[model samples]
Target: NDKLKFTIRGSYINNLTSKNSRVNLNTGVTWFAGKGWTVNFLNTSSFHRVTNNTGSSSFTSSYFELGINKSFDIQQPRHKYYNYTAVFYKDLNGNRIHDANEPGVSDVLAEIIRANPEQDLKDKNYNGEFLSNELYSNDKGKIEYDNIVEGVYNIKYIPKDIQNAHYESEGTEKQFVAKKDTVMYIPFMERNKLFGKISLHRTQHSALGDIPLGNIKITVEGNDKTYSALTDKEGYFEMYIPVSDYYKVKINNIFREHFTLRQESYIIKFNGYKRFELSFDFDEKARKIHFDESDFLITDEEENGNVSFEDIKVIKQTNLRGIVKDANSLLPIHAIVSIFNNKTGELISETASSRRTGVYFTSFFAGDSYTIKVKAQGYWTYTEDLYLNQITTFDNVNRDILLRKTYIDEEIKTENLRFKSGNSELSALAKAELDNLVSTLFLNPDIIIEIGGHTDDMEALSVNAKQLSEMRAKAVADYMKQRGLSEKRMKIRALSNHDPKSRLDTPEGRAQNRRVSIIIAGF
Candidate 1:
């Protein structure tokens, strides 16, 4: 009996219905909405058994689940109290109580923010948000919280499925001292909005060209709300505003003005020209913007479908610039510059060095010869003839001119001052002309001169012309010194008939050959 007991074994049942595999066909549709609200239209009733025992009876089961759950509040205090409710109304009075005249605002967002620690449960999820689809408020405007805990909370009214209304927070945030089974309530408010499209452009301030202006900031200041948007890549923008008062609009720091939204929707364009129109499109929405074409005006509309504004700039040509200076000092000086067109033999332009700065500037053309004459009142004239040899389009050509002091050479004159024949005495005319020369020296105290006398060939061969000329030059020098002039201001010299004023055999030649010469020595 002991050996039989140790060898004994049990027989197995092959297949039982409950012991076989079961199929769980989960088929649920979840509709996720904004602000963390979701609805699960699920059928938990679909199920079947895969395998069953041959001698056993099988069974099928199905059920429908209709439920609502809240977000697992990680900050929810331990639930030792009753559940609570929150109602959203169309309007609430200043006393924070629901009035009998106020109707319920269904589908309006209601949420409870808890101020407590959470119990970390692994399987049961709590997302920490609330929804009011319960039978207590007739399943209309109430969000009920189960397993209520003691904590501080705030109830907010959030608008959903918004249309053309201006929805703003109406100071409707209600703080909850949530006791046990209390129903909290708050008000939701809204206004109307003025919708419009804004188009911007950067047309060359001139008639030359234009381009799309993008990334420019546009701000709309209004009574109820202020909106800001940056222009897109296409230089287009739009704004949805609340009840339009006199709204002041600013476009990038360029300019600002105010406008009233009397119509439903309008279009604004910053354009370069009145006739040039930039194209855009508008859709047929409930409150759509319509642009009636018009030239850029602060307060006016055209019969056509357009809006325009003017923003222009002038075009300019290239120029040449530099300073005029004294050649010795290398410092700026006021000099007169005369430009001449050598090809046309005409004076093209005349510019002067600025007395204040001595800087000079002018424009010129290529493929032309220009004679630049730079002169000052006290300095020698500087004449420079140049050709704009290279033909190219560029800017800022530089040309600086320097002038020297003036000095005169008496030999450059055609006829020299004459004396009486065979006599070293000054002629009546000669002394008269000498009066002018002396007066010039008197007026210009800085001027000094050299005096020289020369004789003709026939007169020199007959008399001691060399000695006579020397005596004549000395005599003229003495006359000037006796006239109250400084002897240090003059130098006297003489020459024979070798240097003649003229080569012709005539009385005029002989008279010009024998003369006294004067030269500027210093100033």
Candidate 2:
């Protein structure tokens, strides 16, 4: 009602000499919009009459007018309001981009400090350090402060106040000029990188022979939480974790079954803000040691902040080195080299001859007799026995090998080449007989042969007879494959009890029937 205006007016005049009378009427309406704007309309009407001269004549005229009006009221301006917004969010994927699926963090308290004032006028109560109040983020993770004066300011948050230990802020403080509404984004990432290496301690006697265990899983557990990392090609694993009182670090259980850890799990007390490095190894004679906190801790006495594992004494490796070549052509041969301890009858180490260089090397303890076997495709396997006495130095012992080439088809059958009852694994006698055949197959690469598997009729049911025969043939084929023979050069046949090398009436004949025979099919 205050924005609208209305007016009405009337006037009357009388002439005494001419006896004439006049009348006028006017009406107007005005509407006021905000900020000095108005719309107005007016109407006017007039009537006149002469009584003596014109004997009563009357006329009336009316007109309407419409208009819009604006008024500028110049007054002293009030303080303009500006806003500062801080957006707090977690960087879930570590890409640094705030995705729509990622949720915003709430209740984050941020403080604002004015770096510069709009005017040089400094009040005695004004301090440069902080504002009067702290801003808190709402459920949408937006910390907003309004009615801020135009000035340069800083927004900051304390790391300890975040409450989430696993996350570290990307930016601790942000400086901006709040001439208008301003928005700043703060992201947090996983904190505390833990890195270490995994190795295999071959033996206490061979300190320089440790092998890096690559592509293995290492896990870290602390405060009812677990984190894991996969070793790279260099057997190094790294992960980020939260600050905890203590942590238990260990390798995969599959590795534990194969090799023994001196300490199954390592426990370390850790604090925040520092990265740590450690190493571990699996050994055959690694006895279960008591958990010594000092053994896996970084003390102030240490110059570097690295957690040290047991220091392995360095020792020189007694290596065996050689080259394998064709006996006739004198050409290099890529071969599989293996060493076995003569006294213990155990394999010491295995290596391969370089395809281009035909060079191979392996390490072992001295003062023991060892047998070296070199096998290659298209060449006969070479075997030799040598003794490294106590006088042998740490220097490599060089012994070259020459393999014979074969061009003829040869089949050697032995009754001792038999599998154990109800099993497909090759026994010592079977392996010894097959080793000779492996060389022949390797020496002559063009020879394709049929491996005939057979079983005795001792089983009451022949249900597993064919399967067992097939497995036995596969076992022989797999062995040759390991010894550097191609599968394409060999064919398998499961003959079962149908084919026999000897009569089945006697026990000795049955033993002979359970043998596998290798027959050359073609060149």
Candidate 3:
């Protein structure tokens, strides 16, 4: 009887089976590789052993078979992303773009910066500092940048080794974005395209070309920038400015042909694509610009409106006359008279008087209010308000005004003199009046005056006269000396108890006796 036992062994096989006199074992292994590749190995083994080994001579039989198989999971290729590029060239001259064969060409530095679309782009130099990652242009005045993300970018260019060369191109900043793969071009041009002609015409149909207005500097300021140009031989000048906001133009010259003919400044709103013609008319004789009368129109007219000849009725044209005098003495006071419109408060005229007669005259329209203000040295200011509502024809309005003389002393019967009670010290108010007197003497240079002191009859004649008169007279002399007044221009005298202007029996009379007087000696 022949019986058999089967056993199978392998790294990947855990069990073996046999049927119909044949056995098969399954085994497999897997390995991983880079780039998404995989490898696998499998094997099958079978073995037969004599079960009735009683014979001990039974033979063992084994069968093995190797099979190979391959399977692959394919993968697709990935797409590559591309970036945008920007290139530019700067022309150092003002003649638009650079010529191919131009000589003495200098290098220009430029930088390309990526700007985040979600954020606003700002120049790093705003805080007066330079930032990193700024690119510079090549020696050929060329700049290029690439691998820029899909967003905005700014290109900045600066000229190298060029001094005093004018530029009219867009400044260092060029704003652009790379929505898709794109190539951007930025060209910088020079600013030397300024040229223009100017002609002047007079109302007399004469050309004033002979008037030499040498290189008048004309400045155009706009968009946080300023540009200057000079007037040419034909009184014409042209200036080139970067394309930006409107420009404010101003002209300046040495000679003012007319008070209004000085360079006029205006806004030039037009773009620089076309030529602009500006005509200037100057009247040298009248020193004024002959503008169309229609330009000066009165838009509003009311009873109390501003002074406009066409707005109100001139019921009468009168020369108003007035005299300013000391309110207490009715004596004329020399002063400066300033007249103004009461409604508009505009000073219409002013005049100064040489003599003590404070008289002034000016023309005014009827039914108008006028204010006259008088200002004099050492005198309180006097102001008068007048309403001319009655005069219907050309007439003279006599308005006399009396200004109160500012006195250091009122009871003392003396002109421009003051004193402390029972003492020779001059009061502050008295010193102020004396200061004016001293100024007058200095101005005249040849004027002289007598300083006199007086006393009342209450004291003994000889003793009171000597003491009181001497003290008072010495006080005046000392004041003059302190004020830089030459002693040669003054003389002192003490009248003592003599020449009393008031009665000795009354208190007012005694007060008047204690006084001092300034008598003008000569001019």
Provide the overall lDDT of each model, using Cα atoms, as 2-decimal numbers.
Answer: 0.56, 0.72, 0.57
Question: In order, what is each prediction's RMSD in angstroms?
Answer: 31.5, 24.8, 28.3
Cand. 2 Cα-lDDT? 0.72
Off by over 4 Å in 2: 1-189, 196-218, 222-237, 242-246, 251-264, 268-338, 342-363, 367-369, 372-391, 396-435, 438-523
How does each model score on TM-score?
0.26, 0.28, 0.27
Count of clashing pairs, candidate 3: 7
Instruction: Give the alpha carbon lDDT tens digit for every residue of 16-110 in model 2.
Output: 88888999999999998888999999999999887875478888999999998888744224434477787777666556667787677776777
Best by TM-score: 2
- Weakest ten-residue segment in model 1 by summed lDDT: 2-11
Q: Give a tens-digit lDDT track for model 1, residues 1-523.
A: 3111111222223336356444444455555443445555555443344454465344556656654445543444533355777776654332335788766665666555653425423315444433323232323567777755555666655656546434333454577765666876655433333233343332322111222234445676655556776565466665543333245555552111111223322243222211212223222213223555642344534435343343322223235566898889888898777777768868765666666457765554443577777767666556677655543354446688777655655431313367666778876666666665675566456667778888887898799998978877877787777777799888887887877878978887887877888777776
TM-score of 1: 0.26
Q: After superposition, how far is residue 88 of candidate 2 from its true place, in Å?
A: 12
Candidate 1 residue 379 C-alpha distance from true site, Å:
59
